[model samples]
Target: MTNPYAASGVDTEAGDRAVELMKQAVSSTHNNLVLGSFGGFAGMIDASILKSYDHPILATSTDGVGTKVAIAQAMDKHDTIGQDLVGMVVDDIVVTGARSLFMTDYIACGLLEPTRIADIVRGIAKACKAVDVALVGGETAEHPGLLKPHEYDVAGAAVGVVEKDKILSSEKVQVGDVVLGLQSSGLHSNGYSLVRKIVADNNWQYTDLIAEFGRTLGEELLEPTALYTGVLNKLLQDIRYQNKFSTMSHITGGGIAANLSRVLPAHVSLDVQRSTWQPQPVFQVLAESAGINLFDLESTWNLGLGFAIVVREDSAASIIGSLRELGVSSWQLGVIEPKPENAESKGYLSSAKGTHGGSVRLVGEYAK
Candidate 1:
């Protein structure tokens, strides 16, 4: 028997095998809330949990691994990429003071390798379990003609829930509010296009070892993004910390100043000090190797801080101490202050991602 679909480059049998291999990992993320089983036309999650909230708000976000997928693909490592996807999508939901309830992922690839697909899904399932989110459903589409074989990209969307009154909108930011910089686990999956450009320009090999990173270039670049949802959820649940944090920025594509600005109130501004903490050596290595301006690097990648939280000045120490106990290094960037009539700065990001809210200015010198 001749299979037209296989001839057309879509392997149905491989897809079935991939699904079969992914079964255990997927089922592991499932809870009693998940309805039906895998392979259903659509996924259903029990929404009864929302009834507990007087005014529940549904929060959803969609995001991908970005060009960092190239690093995973380059290294032939698929496991950690799923964690990165979870970090990107669910973490954004966390910024709204929501607890992720469910998630779905989409993978488009030129070829359907059963083991590879299973590995990616396993990572996704593992990460979902870590944050108590269910991997309700997902799709793996093979686009052989549109994409080169061995190439694939993964994206996912997460749904979370928060009580209306419990949402942290950053409107509470005041002159005495403290800005805390949450340390990142390396680059954490943004600005990879520039990273690729740097590698290509310098003729660097993925196998090449940079003394500063203490690992092969590819390995250093592939570090999975640090998951913050569990930590945030814990903070929100604690009596001492509930509503203590008014604003949080998931420092992604816009770098520090821009993402931080998205949460600032119009009446105040934040001065993110560079000396708060030393940047990871990866940034210094890339900056010196690329010979690019530090500002250019700062505007693209996180440099060091992965997440920013604005809290009442009195709560700053406790929050930092909590983060430390949670195994995340933390420091203060600056304090919130009233926006002056004549606000100007040599280094500032007024707005980003079409957000024209409060502004942020970079100040102080690097610790080197």
Candidate 2:
């Protein structure tokens, strides 16, 4: 019997094989909390554990790998993109002071290449295991006419839990709190559209080795997003730093200012010192190649800091010490201040919004 779907480039057998190849990796992330495996109709996690909480609030987030998938396709590298996907979605939940419980991913591809798909799932499983999050289930759709055969896009949704009193929000942020900046691994999965455009403009090939990066441009850019949940989970579990922490921001699209501003309380403004950390080589290279100013660069890419936290000024030293103990490099970027009269400044900081949503700004030299 002729198979209609196979002829149309939707290979059911390939999909099945991909699932088979991915089973062990997926199963490795499962525990008693994960009720069943990925083959089920839906992913299941035993929330019975939540009964221990006086008031449990579930935090959920969904995000895609963005145009960075184009780079993955260009390099034929599928593994690390999964980590990028997990970082984008799961870390957002982490910002809410929630521990990730489970995650499901979706991949849309022009064709189902079993090995490639397996590689992607393996990355996701590894990251899930690292963060103790269950890889409950996922979907991979083969779109023949809709997407190019060589191209695929990845996205994921993560669910997490925190006690109602433990949730991190702007309400807890106050004037004089210190903003701590966590170093990024690289571009960390955002600003790839600008990255791609810069590469295209400069005629840079994915395989071309750049001296500054000390590796192929594609390899440097494809570096997996740093997994902060483990370190953060450590911080959250410790008693000393718990209540002292106010809120966190995962620097993503619209850069540090935009993402940080989303979590600021009405009266507090985030003051960022540009010289606090060194900019990675990739940012400098992109800025030079694209002729982008520091302001646009900071607004587009992470500019070095990928994750940030607002903590009571007194707790800043302890938090940085703890981050150091976890082997994560961090520094105090600036202090929260009462919203100023003009509320707008140039340099590393975003224009301050007096009260209401708040604003971030950068001041000082860009440490090369």
Candidate 3:
């Protein structure tokens, strides 16, 4: 009898081999709470930690590494991509004031290269350990004709827990609250499609940028996504300061203005001072070389701010100071204001403090 799976270009044997190679890499990330083995369809996590709360809200987010994967392929590095995968999803869940508990990944490829798959799993393990989450299980499919022989895509799903009363939603945000900007590790995966075009147009090789990074362009581009687990977990631990932090936003595909607007209530608007922060040099280089408009830069990339915390006016300094103490570069970026009465208004009604001694107005459509 002919094997239908083989005819379809998926080799079960190769898939098995890939799993075997990734077993150790995945197991290394397991802690006391990981249940069963590594091949389960769904990961099982011991959620007894949540028993203490009267009502525990489970926050789950799924995301891909985006076109940043192309850079990884160009650089021939796969390890850090998994961390980027986990970060993209986990950070989004955490914005709701949740603590990541467990995560799983999905890797699909036209052909399974055991070593490359293992490298990716290893990266996921490293990131899970840093965030104190266990990697319970994941899937690796080997579909020989579905993808380019050497090309693959990766995505992830993360589960987080937050006390029922502790979810940081827009409802708590109010006028007079201060916006705190947390510095990002350059680019952080989004806007890479534009980045690649810029790099190609400049006639600049990845090698040209590697010198500034003290590593190869691939290594720098694959730099693991920064984990905010510990810092946020610490801040959420203080019950007295719970209400002080009214809203949190993870700046991802949408830049600051877009993401922040998501957490703003109908009656409130965010006023960001651009001069309050400096865009990372990589962004500047890309903008100058690619001829990307400033508005596009602000709308697409994070512009160096990855995470934002909206806190009461009085708690702003303390939050910034605390983040600094934890080795995170954060600053007061702006404040919340009453939304204009005219619903048709498309502006911030105010501007960000720019680095050039001028106000920078918000130019993108708010995230609805």
Candidate 4:
């Protein structure tokens, strides 16, 4: 019998084998909530728990690894990309106070390598497990001519659930709120486009950089994205704690300024003290080597702060203490201020006095 699918470069056997491998990898992330394994067109989760809430909000976000994939490919590391994929999507949902319930991923590549694909899936499974989210389903496509050999693009969609009344938005933010900064694990999958160029221009290789860390560059960059789920989950369990948490921001592309501003109420402004923390050495090296302007570093890369928590100033100390107790590094990076006289222009961000080496505003300006 002649097989028409193979003739079109779609090998059913190859896909089947790939699916088997991915299924095994994904199974490790499953829990009681996951209805099935890898056979369904859409991932299914047990949403029966939502029936208890009077008003439930379903939050969803889709994102990719972005240019960070090039770095993973250039370095031949596949494991951490899955974490990056999950982080990018789930983080966006969490900003609205949603809890990630389930996740699905999509990977398209020109050629299929069972081992490589399995590696990516393993990473995804690990991240999903960390966030207590189930990997319900995913798609792996083999398009030989559409993409470059050994090149694959990864994207995923995450669905989260929250009580409608509990959704965190700008309206909840107040002028007297304190902005707490959460430390990031270097770059956290964004700004890699600039990182790549800087590394290339400076004649730096992933191997050279990893040697300094006493591990392979792939190992470091592949360090799974920090799963903030557990921390935030604990924080939200206590009513007292939840009330203090006004707004949250996930610092991704467009860096701190842009992302932070997204959660700030229009009636308030934020004054960030740049001197509150020092830039990580990796950022310093990249900036000096590439001669990147300070403004670019702050607005483009995270400058080491990955997440921000906007909370009432009175509870700032306790919140920081609680996060520290959880072994998460955090600090008071800034404070919320009253808006300027011009009501329309009220919600503007400013650098605190003596911060950013006294060039705070210029250094943290929005990147065009």
Q: Write the per-residue lDDT of candidate 2 for residues 1-368, one digit (tens) a residue.
A: 87897998899999999999999999999978988646999887788989999999999999998999899899999899989989998888989999999999999999899999999999999999998999999999999999988888888998999999999998998888999999999999988988999999999999999999999999998999998987898899899986998999899887878788878865667678887888888998889888877666877899889999989999899999999989899999999888766665333233333324666677778775
What range of 10 consecutive residues in model 4 has the weakest lDDT sum? 353-362
Greater TM-score among 2 and 4 belongs to 2
Query: Of the candidates shown, which would achieve the greatest TM-score relative to the real structure?
Result: 1
Q: Candidate 3 overall Cα lDDT vs. reference?
A: 0.76
lDDT of 4 by residue, 227-291 (tens): 67768877877676867888798888776766776677555666677777766656666676787
lDDT of each: 0.88, 0.88, 0.76, 0.76
RMSD of each: 1.2, 2.1, 5.4, 5.0
3 versus 4: better TM-score goes to: 4
| lDDT computed for candidate 2 | 0.88
Error of 2 at 365 (Å): 1.3
Error at 182, model 3, angstroms = 0.5
Q: Which ranges in model 3 have alpha carbons more than 4 Å from their true place?
A: 1-11, 209-216, 343-346, 349-368
Segments of candidate 4 deviating more than 4 angstroms? 1-4, 209-220, 342-368
Q: Provide the TM-score for each candidate, comma-separated.
A: 0.97, 0.96, 0.88, 0.89
